[model samples]
Target chain A: MVHQYKLNGYHIVLDTCSGSVHAVDEVAYDIIGLYEEKTEEEITAQILEKYRGREDVTREEIRLCLADVAKLKQQGKLFTPDTYAPLANEFKERSGNVVKALCLHVAHTCNLNCAYCFASQGKYHGERALMSFETGKRALDFLIEHSGSRTNLEVDFFGGEPLMNWEVVKQLVLYARSVEKEHRKNFRFTLTTNGMLIDDDVIDFANREMSNVVLSLDGRKEVHDRLRVDYAGNGSFDRIVPKFQKLVAARGGKNYYMRGTFTHQNPDFTRDIDEMLRLGFTELSMEPVVCAPADPAALTQEDLTVVLKEYELLAQKMLDAKREGKEFTFYHYMIDLTKGPCIYKRISGCGSGTEYMAVTPWGDLYPCHQFVGEEKYKLGDIWNGISNHGAQEEFCACNAYTRKECEDCWAKLYCSGGCAANAYHAAGSVSGIYAAGCELFKKRMECAVMLQVADALPRQE
Target chain B: MKRIQTLETKNLCESAKKGGCGECQTSCQSACKTSCGIANQKCEKKDER
Candidate 1:
């Protein structure tokens, strides 16, 4: 249950079950590697040979390393038995249809054409359309009807730009509120927009009715402008920044996130975050771009080292901000290991097909928003409730438990296997691992752990 | 058996409330649980120590 990796010139070992992290020396690292498979005598022998020529090597040293291994075993940091199987079995046995959240593609056409747009400028590789009020209403009804005993239901108005279909979006919100009282459900609405179309009306409506809004802004004007261009091939930064500031000011800058994406072009992505902080944004999430590997802007193997370094720098900056009493939560740096792994997360992955499904503008249902444009992943439509139950079942069954690559992985517990869409995009299979994303996730986790440790260390007087 | 019982009895919402599950409020609890894979157990016995 212990996973080891080298970072910042130190070997960091994470015990998945107990959530214990240790920065161990090379001998300790080697011993941990052999503890599960080799006998102590064998481990000692191997260690002895590994350091035989070194002046620092000694039989006492090897014995001490073995003792340390035994201590870890006694403390339950190492040799923690696999408990995933029984839990996986129970999860599979108890898996049921409980649709709790729905992502409604309110508009399938966006004004701006981001270079890395997964939906290919928001058309999703299909005809540009807006969700008719009729379809949106049916989708809302479908969620309430299928939600079972879940009192808090969620619906995300997603799109090329949900703002494009402002009237339908508003009508749907009002309608959802009207139905909520009778259904004994609380509808939590969220709007994910490109911020180009934000106006006083949109801001006022969102503040009053929307649970939260996720506004996309890449970062500095130069960085954002390079990729996020409007119909006239002009940068959106100048247009969106003022609107974003206005919207944030209207909402008192709460219950909103200024979400950005980092790509190969910006390996030192911390600078972008610094710019966001300077712009007075409190809630921020800068995610790595998910695009084809062949895309020029895509983060490739060459960018990983710099990406890793930037994450470390960002972690340090976060620590400094906390010390200065100006703490802001970075989405990726947030990891709580105190509680054991979430059984639900391990078994289900990202609820793409099971508990949450995406409804296209045309009333077509897919497992998640990422699959809206892809025909192969279509589950059903609003008229027919989940015709492709098999697809849902497949998503339900997918987890680190089912993935062979994740079986022996220590990071598996933290990651719970990665995003299903990302996996599909990278490996052409839902169950496959996206190598780049996987590495980035691990690197982020490492940085998070380091940050946690740094934060715990007392400030020098 | 102990672990399974611990997991069953633990409150997923409580841990989520403590900011352990970052996007809990914004996400479907069932789906988030499935995705997190963190078995809902009594806050780790170690944390109590």
Candidate 2:
């Protein structure tokens, strides 16, 4: 299917199934829009009348444009048929459910209490605890054992505050590095922290060892301070921002994300993004607050309306910045149009549950961090591997085409059927779809497409 | 910024049918896909100044 839209002074057309993108002038754009339903003669007449005053839009030019659109259709470039439904289930089969990555919850406790934290302040509704070194070691071994023939194994040090158990995180990284060579494996380690405990040692070790570091900050001081607070009910923004800035500065050219969550309290998230930009943060992501509908921080329908406009504004701002040699990258807008995810990844989604799983501090396995502490989703422990094969099969069966709502949606392929954890939380099933997240995703996809169109296509005016 | 129209696809998965899926490690990011400010993989490509 061909989806057409006008954005940022350009007419962009995208073929959803085939992943073909085209930019055309006004007459050509109009003709391509009605090429399917209307007769050629009718389209030509409509275009002629629409552009009647423009001498540049003659019937001869319309004919050529019509021929070009038809040529694209014949070549399976535009209006491409959806032939991926049957292959969707085949993704899990191709890899044989070999494990590839693990998100190790080193600590189930947080230094700061953020109101909208979906992790429930890192406890996940459980008691506070730090993963023992023994548990972490076993988790790594579990990943290696289950990962058949895959050399590039990934482990992310995540938690309430990974740095809270600093010694264990350090030891785990050291252990992984030491064993990787003997096993003929390459372990890429990443760490995500709130920047509360960042210092010389943290910075030095992260730079030297971790493949990537993710720092959490919610834009400006007021917005950040509103929810992210300390035990004393004091805002932790002041405490964390300086630390994060110092860490990023020391990080130099290394990869990092200055991540933030925009809640209903701040649906004008573009301002927060601007705040991040002003703080010299270029690599950023300001996600909408995803929580139970009853939660005060949860994004409401009205908030969603504002948030959509914010995405559009953010895209336009990025384009302007790119032109001015001040471009900042947004996580959602980082669309590698040329060589995106492989077909297997595109159809199968995030590879969670089967190819990837989350390990709690105690070594209990879940589909992902979002499913941690939930008995229903517990697949097994690191010692015995995945005992609950049913959960694995369920995640394996879940993909872009699993839900009927996603069948006709143009953004289906991009999002990979949305997050399974989000689906389960919202719709009470892993296979179900999160309607709000879907709407936000569609808007982001549109903006992402617009950015690529502006950057990759020739503009008419 | 001179934007040019382009088709950005190598369709590598197309070759997977011929048994080419697992061998390619291609720039796939983090294992966990959930975006709970925790597991989401950071994809930051900083442009060299």
Candidate 3:
């Protein structure tokens, strides 16, 4: 199927099946739009009527444009067939359950009390707990044991605030390092924290041992403080921002993301991103908050419109900034058109249950951190491995094709059927599509494509 | 009116899909390597033109 849209002064057409992107002029765009549905004679007549007075848009030129569309289709770049549908299930199955990543919830508790905390203030609506070093060690061992021929395995030390259990976090890294070479594995660890406990030691060790670090900051002080407040109801923005700056500064150009969440309160989330840029934080991601619609922080219908425009503006701003020699990386806007993820990766979506799982502080496994509290999703523990084979199979099958809503969606390949965790929360099933999220995601994809086009086709002065 | 210009004919269907698991590349939808270290594009493969 083909999808067409006009954004940022450019007409874009996406061949959904073949992943080809074309930027055509208004005339060619109109002709291509009609090529699949109308006969050549009819399309020419329509274009002639539409561009009646324009000499450039003659019937012959219209037919020429139509021929170009036909050429693209013949080359398998336009109106391409869904050749990957039959291969989706078997393609993913070939990966064969070789787990390569594990999210170790080192602390099921947080030092701060962010009102919009999806994990219910890091307790995940459960008792506050910290994972023991032994449990973490076993979790690393579980990864190595199941990683098959994969040499590089990843472990993310996540939590309400992982620094809440600082000693164990350090110990687990030491343990993983101690055994990585022995097991013929290379462990890349990441720490996701609120920046509440960053210090010289934390920064030094993070730069040394951790391959990457994710610092949680919701942009500007007022915006971040609105929901991410401390238990005493005071803003923790001041306390954390400086520390985050220091840690990232010491990171020595290593991998780090100044991750934030955008909600109804901040639909003009680009302002928050600008604040991050002002603070010298380059790699960034401001994800939309996925919560109940009834919640005050939820993005309302009006906010969706604002958010969509913001995505377009964000892309343009990034391109302009690059020209001015101040380009920053926005996570979703980073698209590698040349060597993007293979079709199987795009089809199967995020491997939440099949190849990746989240471990709780008590060593119990869930498909991801979002499903941590739900007993039904519990996929056994590190010691016993995945006992809930049913959930595993369901997630393994839950790819872009599994969701009916994704069938005709143009952005399905980029998002890989959307996040299963967000889908479950929004629609009450992993296979269900989060409609609002889809809208925002499509806009982001459009903006990403436009940015790529702008970079390639610099405008003439 | 630039005509119908193909900005990208990378053809992810035929080329990209054939490679087994590229969990670390920016192309993967997971946002990062293996377990989603969260938007980790530090290792983004430069375009091999």
Best by TM-score: 3
| lDDT measured at residue B36 in model 2 versus the true structure, 0 to 100 | 20
Q: Give the Cα error of residue B38 in candidate 3, in Å.
A: 12
lDDT (Cα atoms) of all candidates against the true structure: 0.73, 0.78, 0.80
TM-score of each: 0.83, 0.93, 0.94
Instruction: Give interface RMSD for all predictions.
Output: 9.8, 6.6, 4.6
Q: How much lDDT does candidate 2 score?
A: 0.78
Winner of 1 and 3 under lDDT = 3
Q: Please report, as a residue range, the 10-residue window in candidate 1 chain A with the lowest summed lDDT.
A: A452-461
Point out the higher-scoring one by DockQ: 1 or 2: 2
Residue A273: error of model 3 in Å? 1.3
Off by over 4 Å in 1: A5-12, A21-77, A339-341, A459-461, B1-49
Cα lDDT of model 3 by residue, B1-49, tens digit:
2497786545666654445543453222233321121111222224421
Docking class of 3: acceptable
Backbone clashes counted, model 2 = 6
Candidate 2: deviation at residue A41, Å? 2.0
Task: Write the number of the candidate with greater TM-score, choosing between 2 and 3.
Answer: 3
Pull out the clashing pairs in model 3. A341-B27, A342-B16, A343-B17
